[model samples]
Target chain A: MNQIDIGKWSQRDLNMLRTSSDTREIDLLTTSVRDLNATLQAFGSNTRSDEASFRVLTPNGAHAIAVGIDAPLNVEIAGHVGYYCGGMNKCASIIIDGNAGQGVGENMMSGVIHVKGDASQCAGATAHGGLLLIEGNASARCGISMKGIDIVVKGGIGHLSGFMGQTGRLVAFGDAGEALGDSIYEARIYVRGKVESLGADCIEKELRDEHRAELFALLKQADEAHKADVSEFRRYGSARKLYNFHIDNAGAY
Target chain B: MCGIAGLFIKRTRLQPRLGELLASMTSTLCSRGPDSAGFALYTAGEPGRAKLTLTSVEERADFEALGEMLSRAVSAPVSVVGRYTHAVVTVPADLVNLCRNWLLENAQDVRILSEGGHLEIYKEVGYPDDIARSFGIASLGGTHGIAHTRMATESAVTATGAHPFSTGPDQCLVHNGSLSNHASVRRELGRDGIVPQTENDTEVAAGYLTRELKRGRSLGEALKSSVEDLDGFFTFVVGTKNGFGVLRDPIACKPAVMAETDDYVAFASEYRSLTPLPGIKSAKLFEPKPATPYFWEH
Candidate 1:
């Protein structure tokens, strides 16, 4: 058996391996990002039943690290990443050990992206499906236009979070900045701490048993089931007042 | 979009590497603003001496004879250190105004970039890396620095329109967003005898801070009030003789990421610019909150 040192393997060498169950390590310092994404993208077309795991080292705040992955492969990024780290992700679990720049998991179809450190503005904007778990705080305008995605933030979220969401679930364990869920629709928000102010067309709603069950499941998925209680959280959703062209509510428009 | 980067050294041992670290940081932001680049560096100053940074297109014809003429006018030894298209003239602290007035009346070709005891500003219409290399920024030593790369939104891409705009002694400001009410604010400032050097909006903001500081307001107070007075989207990084400050507008659409360690506090438009710094992996990184003023002084 020939044991290949994964660290010494070049981009050409990595390209030769069609499918493998072994974990591959790709150092971004030595390998180009184009090659890394190309390899990950190739897994989407593979017919193999085995799963592949990849470990990316020294991300160094590079943009578009592992975008457009369509397989159930697990990818772990070691350091900080720039804009759109795991954008348009599908069926893959991407973990970022360090901070992430703007739009960490934008427009993902399915799967999970876990950011261990803080995330910049718009953490999970316009995503149709999947989960984005942020251990640290997320800055302004998180989940601006979501179709269907589950987001669990362990820390605080900045202003205008969950704005104009058509359908989704956003859970924040810490305090929320001003104007939470402005002009929102259908998407539910559960915040445990203080909400600075609710946005236009968004209002606090009673948390029922089903909502509690949903929140509990999300908290468990984020590994904070024991740290936070479902009953302690308050639910917010659209008031549905501005849904139509009402003459009385012209000021809101 | 524009890019802003700043570094304030907390540990005395790291002060000597300020320029080298800032140069690397600024180089990473070349894509954000490639039209022009500028930087302001603060060094230790003598008690009775002041420095004026000047730039001219005709460096040889304008700078060579101006130093001797200014020295004779001020009756003090004024030494000029000339680099590519820029020079720093040191004069007696009390005679700085006289020297400035003489230069304004006598030297029509030379333009003053900054005037202060410890501050020296260098800026040009070029790529950030090229500008940093031309000024030898990597070899210079300083206590703190602020740099800007401009994309030229509101004004022409001239050297004077480039950022790190200095309106007062030892004070400079770099902005990453556009101001909506600069024309009104410029007119308002004109009533108070505060005139901006360029049509650029960032310079108008710098002039506003200079007026505020001249009125006995601290840097923090000035920044806090700026959020209310300036109507625009902005992430401003301000540098003074002894401090550094960062502030964002209430509607902070522009991006700003800040990192702090035991040795220094750094701010950039994006996280990529900070990757070149030492011990950055262990640094406490966070985005500056909106409508808040954060300041650190020596």
Candidate 2:
């Protein structure tokens, strides 16, 4: 497949290319959300095509861009995106040039999503496995109900983040908001700054050598290992004592 | 789910473009809400007069005659202007309640959308863009405005059921989540004489704010108090005569993003609705904290 130069193509040319089944490498600028979604849907269904890559221009905070991508490909969105970008992603590497709205990389199985700016609430909610990187802050519930996904936020995270988190690792380089990690499970959380309050069943733990090593490796994967020293971060997880029913803790429940 | 957009212009130069900018912001959230849409625009109003925006199934039912009847009853001159299925009635400020009561008795089918010195609300059952176009929103100018596109959860889809529900003079609210204890709260507000028009949780929430503000509580204070009384997941963007405010529940399960520039302060249910604003790429962006009322006034 030849490299397609999106800089020279008009919006109409991009639209025509999206409709053509033979085009493997496409560059799209100024396309409507419906058309772009249609092109991505085609890519998800067409298994016979060779490796395909796409470059999106002027996203203008459109929602649901690059969703349901199951193929192993590359896509770059040049501007900010709205909710559910890279949702249900699989075997892809998606990059965003600007801030993201809610649920970016939501419910993903396997992928690498890079956000150049901050992310809204539930940034990587309910994802199974992937690497979600945010260069800036993430709002409330950043990793709510995650199954197994590694997330790294270079800035602060908001309240109730990592709520009911079952598994995976969440690393924050800045302060965490109130009620962080409410009702959390086996997920490991590493924070570099102060926590306003801890939620029920979530308690601070010692950052042992093993935890430090895991956080260091995760930060390296996010390409932000040098931002903060792994030893400076604190670890948090479930208390585990609440998992079993006890008569003495019935009042607390 | 519902979508909300708000624009507060700090610069007078941008006031003329408020509706156009607001329309674009509201239209970007079409995917969030395709059931119905509405907006409350704040513009200049004559002193000593109050405006009431009402929607009627019958658009051409001689609103002028109804206005004459209201004028005679209130001992003031009243004028009504019809736009599409909505009518704006201007009357003496002291007689606004009398006009509302008279409408309840005389025009049972007509519902007051908003009553304020500067607010004129337009709402309908349709997509956000189509509702904006049908109401000529692009041509309307304002100092600030708020729009809502709703996917109904608690109530049926109707013009009156749409959001930007105004319960007090120059006050409107748009919500993006459902209330868990609305029935009980509705009963509580009913005892306080703040009867809502519908069973929709948002209306109950609006009535709660109005009741608080009527008790002399400030907008920020009312929203702050909502955290304790209003139980549910919610992201609320409220507009007053001279202010714009945003609040989220303690949990903040819903999504809300805000951006501020020298010219304007914008709020959207998601960042996509706010991206089209001027100087947005360089604007100061932040998510409002849970259980905190962030407000800015002119």
Candidate 3:
């Protein structure tokens, strides 16, 4: 067990280590996930003024890589990851150089997760706060049940994206698949390409100047502002029809 | 939840490593399903010859002297190779139906796992790694293969309930999700003279595909129709004599990832299953879309 004893390090020593720009490389082929996560968790418990960069190699679709971090850190994973990569992340910037499996940033509290390749279903499902950027396509339920997260996809999104979204912003530069924003709440959706269909209680809304500003900010935060034009995007949100039960809408229920 | 792994070798040079690659692929999914595992391999066979994979609970009572009895009944040179509780029997292609009928009448205790020219199916109630090792799967050679690890969602944890259910000659199907309308579909197929051997829903799906192919529908057509007729969350990987097909339901909650390279095409319930394949680092990976059928033929 290559465990780090954070308790033994004095505050002065921790401050000195935090000020130094140290880059650590952890190879998944040689190190077990338990050790890697323990080391990262140790860093999470210790506050640092400078960003510590950790490069993880050969993830090979392993689940729960770099999850539950609570401090500022920069993680670069060189290969594909399985379920829940960077899940519950906070104050960290995690970049996946390859594709990611289901729920890439699920339930993340705050931070940024950038997936260079495609992502599987439920990319940012139920996330509360985070900026999830997918450079490639995202499969079904890209932001399903999202609360406060902001997701930006450079490519297309599959069906049922933002389904039952409570509060969030989902932006896609490419086409949106079937049933976009089905039964959505206060969440806002922006699509530059074709929307195959809208789901129950989800309808297109006016993209006012305020929305344009918000979209611009999100795009800039995702480092994709230059790739898309704000004028080309359209917005969708809840119609609030299914918010209450009624006899006329019993079939939908 | 269950796990499914499939490999189709496009390059002939890579055929010899099919079983080896598939073994490594399926082994990674042991955690997803730990109850039972099975695989169907499409190997090269001699012309005018067919093979049947048979299994019995009591191997000594059912498999011993089976070759001599089958040889006398078929009036041909029959070879039976027994491995653990399963046996592979080879006979003349023209005598396949006769052999099947003879076994049905005489060998009541033996169960047929597969019957085809090039396909051989093996399954048992155990871990995927144990099943693969016991069958010596890594040493076998084939052009394509599909494997499954079962968690026994809708059926008992018996060897017969395992996946890679074969219903047609040189055809097999593996499923990762449970089917809701299997009972009704079973009744419908029964009316067409296609009966499933077990109460397993996946076997019924395999029976449905067999019926469609018997009606002259292509593999792609059969899979496309399954999307409409079958009700439930499912991701199916089916293989024929020279083709491989994949299909997911409309509300595809089940996981399915696919990878393709210049050498081979692979499918799995998760990308982790494919990471062990050669050149997987550079393979084109993507999730199969919902309600869509993707097919490849050699």
TM-score against native, each model: 0.95, 0.88, 0.95
Regions of model 1 farther than 4 Å from truth? A1-21, A45-50, B57-62
Interface RMSD of each candidate, angstroms, one decimal = 0.8, 1.4, 0.5
lDDT of each: 0.88, 0.84, 0.89
lDDT at position A46, candidate 1: 51
Clashing pairs for model 3 are none
Question: What tens digits encode model 2's per-residue C-alpha lDDT throughout A194-217?
Answer: 998998789999888878777877
- Model 3: residues >4 Å from true position, as ranges? A1-20, A44-46, A49-51, B61-64
Across residues A177-198, which tens digit of lDDT does each residue of candidate 1 receive?
9999999988889999999999
Estimate, for each residue in B158-193, the C-alpha lDDT of model 1 and write its tens digit.
Answer: 888898999999999999999999999999899999
Model 2: share of true interface contacts reproduced: 0.88
lDDT of 2 by residue, B1-298 (tens): 7899999999999999999999999988887899999989998899999999988766556777788888888788998987777889998898888889999898887889899999999999998899999888888888999999999988899888999899999999999999999999999999999999877899999999999999999999999999999998899999999999999888777778889999999998877788779999899988888888999999
Please give the range of 10 consecutive residues that has the lowest summed lDDT in model 3 chain A: A6-15
Interface RMSD of 3: 0.5
Can you write out model 3's per-residue Cα lDDT over B1-298, one digit (the tens) per residue? 8999999999999999999999999999999899999989998888999999998755554564887898898899888877767888999999999999998888887889999999999999999999999998898899899999999989899998999899989999999999999999999999999999998999999999999999999888899999889999899999999999999999888999999999999999889899889999889888888899999999
Write down the TM-score for model 3: 0.95
Per-residue error for B95 in candidate 3, Å, reads: 1.1
- Candidate 3 lDDT tens digits, A1-253: 1122222312212122232357789999999887888788777546663657799998999999999988777788998999999999876778899999999999997777889999999999999876788999999999999988889999999999999999978999999999999989888999999999999999999999988888887777666667778999999999999999889998875
